[model samples]
Target: MVLLYDWSDKHKEGVTLMNSPVHASDLPDNQFDIGIVGAGMVGSALACGLARANYRVVVFDRQRPPPFDPQSQPGIRVSALSLASQKMLADYGAWQYIEAMRRCPYRRLAVWEKSAPRLPLPKLGGHRGTLFNCKDIHTPELGSIVENNLTHLALHKAMESLPGITSMCPANLEDLNFSPDTATLTLTQHPPVTMKLVIGADGALSQVRKWANIDFSSDQYEQQAMVITVEYAGKQQDITWQEFTPTGPLAFLPLPDVAGKHYASLVWYNTADNIDRLMKLGESQLIGQIWQHYPDCLPAVTGIVDRGRFPLIKRHAQTYFSKRAVLVGDAAHTINPLAGQGVNLGFQDVMALVAILSRDGKPLADPGEAVHLRRYESERRPLNGQMMLAMDLFYHAFSNNHTPLKLLRYLGLNLADKLPFAKQQVLQYATGIKSPPRWLFR
Candidate 1:
């Protein structure tokens, strides 16, 4: 299903359909119900859901990721996708492609304190670590570690033949105009497009958000994440671990085995200064540093495959919608990566928004109406806020040298490990199946 559209003429305002043409005569030739300003995972997911529900949708992005290969070495950038998110992708028809391409499923997730050496667990007769295993809940696995590009590639593939989905790649968002009932997008590569709703899934610095005059609260996190891919010698393991340090949490997320060797992705969260110094070192030297600082539970790294780094920040749109427009994913909120919940949160937003818009089994009437969009905001805002705050609390509690905080966290972890119900609740939150206890918030 290689559907094609031509942008061969730079001056042309209309795209020429090449292969099997769409039934454009049924609807207005140029107008769309929704126009999404970014084709990243969130934007693409929303497009899939809406188009599958029979809503006209257009997704715009500067570029598309290359097709992923199951045999290729995994990238340093990866996400810990939750179980709830997996079902969403399955519904969107992307999960099958993703499964065929590559993914690493982990049955257990472990979190521990890096400074626990000072207070030996045996001496205190307490737990050595806190762990959540999928088997406890009768689930096959907690989730999967998927390469960022592979997920994007899967979404793009799923969207290729979906009815009412328009691909606007290699196109630039020139400007946006909003009337009382409509929004018009001006793109550099194509003509003007008028839509009832202009969805801003364009990420944190969303131009559509600014154009809609949506205010946002953004704070710079003190830590930067250093990500690296490693090739190791061993069987493919099925456990993900995060060890908290005064700087930040150092995590090891496994990758599927290729050939006879195994692989894993590492994320070292630390202050900007430390990350800068670490990045300046040679690969061998940096690997040596990682081996020294990271927990011994990590698999032996035979070679460093790749490395990258990015600064962390917390961002939340003051509101999710404005005149004839709405924001989703990183455009609405970006949380700390300590729990690897960023993408899952975005997928959750899409699911909520789709549920609100598609309840009628047809394209929404007056799609940009405040009444309709506000429902989405009301449903998602609190949950996203709770997760954001929860991550912040975890960050401060674990990423410090304070004795009292350390001891408190240790005792809490030991207790949590000993209590079956408490551990299940935490897993539910982490896996996006349920929210934290209501008592915590009250």
Candidate 2:
């Protein structure tokens, strides 16, 4: 249970625990209107939230969502959701479904200099100043690990009964014509439709942003991330780990599964050349490399189910909001996936935008107007910028193997640990529960 503060109620404004509503009808088109592109998690969740505010919503996607089949595939398509995001999903009625199928409740996360040598080998593996425990903050769980598909499915399920929300999947976006008055989306099959606003949740390669003449700036990282699911020989843990190497960062995120049978989602980030070599290696050879370098946390690799690679890229639209169109999620910005904040940031965008438009003071019919989308941009930009800067700093800091620099990086981690409040602040910021940008506080 959580308490929601009402900025208005003076008599009993101190604290009031709130229960999330179940299913709600879709908002009527002429009443509260909006259209979201991309039926992914971010788009679907926003649709549900907007519908709950009594806003008519429409969503478009090119592909149909696969059924949530746990046995068929049991790995996160590589993503970690923050606690704040989890709460938002729960409020949107997505948590129950996702938690049931693919949530790994992680209570503790440890990060340290694995390359550092100690007097004794055990001491080297000892808990250094870089550990985060949820119990310390009186929280039941630090964060929940979720699969991208599961989250989307859960959101789709929530939007089922929403009256004003229409989801058109397997539909192609042929054209986007936006003006000061209305945003019209021309579909290949369906009749040309118009809405007050058109969202660009399409992805890194956003068609809506392109059609709307929204320029974007981006750079591809020299390194590529290799993500795979492996069966580990250990207990199911609530720990997320990252080891900074000369090439890049490697991570092991725990997955929820049967007791004693452990599973992990592994991300091996390295230069493109090395990644090419690793990809050529058979599954056994790749697992061997993981075991060799990852000594302490090395889990015996029993199986290799799914494997994929994604070239890291950073992109941000030249403008976030214009006349009758706006961008969100990857279409707006995409940063290094090292910290796993990409999707979390997108979720924040949805929550903040929804909160502002759903407020009583906003215009009802054309909430997607310049004034409204501008408000959304003002609220999201600074926060997104801060996160992007942080990623750049971390990326550059760990990308080098200079002896002095490594020591300095270790010192910084140690200092972060010694300062309790500092550590908590970092945790709070990274996890997206608090320390939201000033505009979002409204």
The most accurate candidate by TM-score is 1
Q: lDDT of candidate 1 vs native?
A: 0.84
How many clashes would you count in candidate 2? 4
TM-score for each prediction? Answer: 0.92, 0.87
For model 2, state the Cα shift of residue 387 in Å.
Answer: 0.7
lDDT of candidate 2 over 1-442, digit per residue (tens): 1011111132245433222212224222321267788878778888888888877677777654567566654654847888999999989888888878767888887777666632332322335538888865668878877778788888888887666676655556688886667888887645676888888888888888888788988988888998888887756677898877777888888876744466789899988888888778787988888777664675677877678788999988888977678888888999999888999889999988888788663436768767878888987887787778778888888888777777777777777766788778778876776775574433
lDDT of 2: 0.75
Clashing pairs in 1: none
Q: Return the clash pairs for model 2, or none.
A: 25-163, 26-162, 26-163, 26-164
Give one clash count per candidate, in the order shown.
0, 4
lDDT score at residue 221, model 1, on the 0-100 scale: 83
lDDT agreement with native, every candidate: 0.84, 0.75
